[model samples]
Target: MSTVQDYASRLSDPGSRKMGTFSYLPPMSPQQIRKQIDWIVQNGWNPAIEHVEPQHAMHSYWYMWKLPMFGETDIDLVLAELEACHRANPGNHVRLIGYDNFSQSQGANMVIYRGRAV
Candidate 1:
């Protein structure tokens, strides 16, 4: 059977716009973050950190922090990098990127911190 359907546009959320999977959820605990980072490492994905001003976060490519931790297996080191990014850019949105080498593409990306004060 073939069917034609018409769709209507709906109003956007009144809540402030958000980006990334974790951004829409409650702030992730350190344990949760550790678990996610662990998965990134276990999957051999290169971890990278990025940040951008909240105003630009919705429409801009986040600025990379230093460089991607290529060939890094230590989860603690990744966490440390994230912490440093936060310390240095406390007023910007921070995210974690897991890049897959074999696929030569991003395997995972998540918002680790939303720096805008609520």
Candidate 2:
């Protein structure tokens, strides 16, 4: 008995979705992203980057930028991968997804980064 309007309203609610450490906030800067990656590494989680064409603002199923960085203690390497993904997929939506084997096998954290407008 839910109508299309109800679904649309929920989808449009900014508070309904939470991405990584930020919610209803602008994209984080490179330094902020590096800090987050460092935290994830400290917690013993693996990080990976993915990207999508971004036909919609909240599109999922992004393609992987490269293999997940497991046991990678180098924050510079993670940042480098992020930059590489952004360079290769300009105008697309990129995300950093973390995996925690201690609890969930995948998607421990996720942050979306909008690419430059074409």
Candidate 3:
């Protein structure tokens, strides 16, 4: 298994040719995209309690994928935490409709919340 330092070194090393940057690549191939999606799904999904607005919820999907270290179980725990925190928040009235990996209304590849439309 790769250590944290190893992963950090890989990310920070300028000389090493890595496929980490999204800037150089255009839209990924179907297989590559599928692998990315699978990885993200395996890590898990979690909503941000402080930013649970319609836009935030929709944007959460992209944000979740951007986080490099999280795993599927971590995501499940995070979503649970968000839900509990959101429910306990004294002033906010936002509700979590839960996460859907494949949102048909949005698109097959897009992950989204199945709640109020933003």
lDDT, candidate 2, 1-118, per-residue tens: 8754322224455334444446445667777788888888888989988887545435646688879987887989988888788888778767777788687676455555665432
lDDT on C-alpha atoms for all candidate structures: 0.83, 0.70, 0.35
For candidate 2, list the clashing residue pairs, or say none: none
lDDT for each residue of candidate 3 in 1-118, tens digit (9 for 90 to 100): 8764333323233323222244234545545544544554553542222323333332334222223222344445544554454455423323222234355121122222222322
Better of 1 and 3 by lDDT: 1
The list of candidate 2 runs beyond 4 A from truth reads 1-23, 56-59, 116-118
Residue 104 displacement (Å), model 2: 3.0
Q: After TM-score superposition, what is the CA distance of residue 62 in candidate 1 from its true location, in Å?
A: 1.0
Model 3 deviation from native, Cα RMSD in Å: 15.6
Clashing pairs in 1: none
Residue ranges of candidate 3 with Cα displaced over 4 Å: 1-20, 46-118
By lDDT, who's the top model here?
1
**Structural similarity to truth (TM-score) of each candidate:** 0.82, 0.72, 0.23
| lDDT of residue 1 for candidate 1 | 94
Task: Name the better of 1 and 2 by TM-score.
Answer: 1
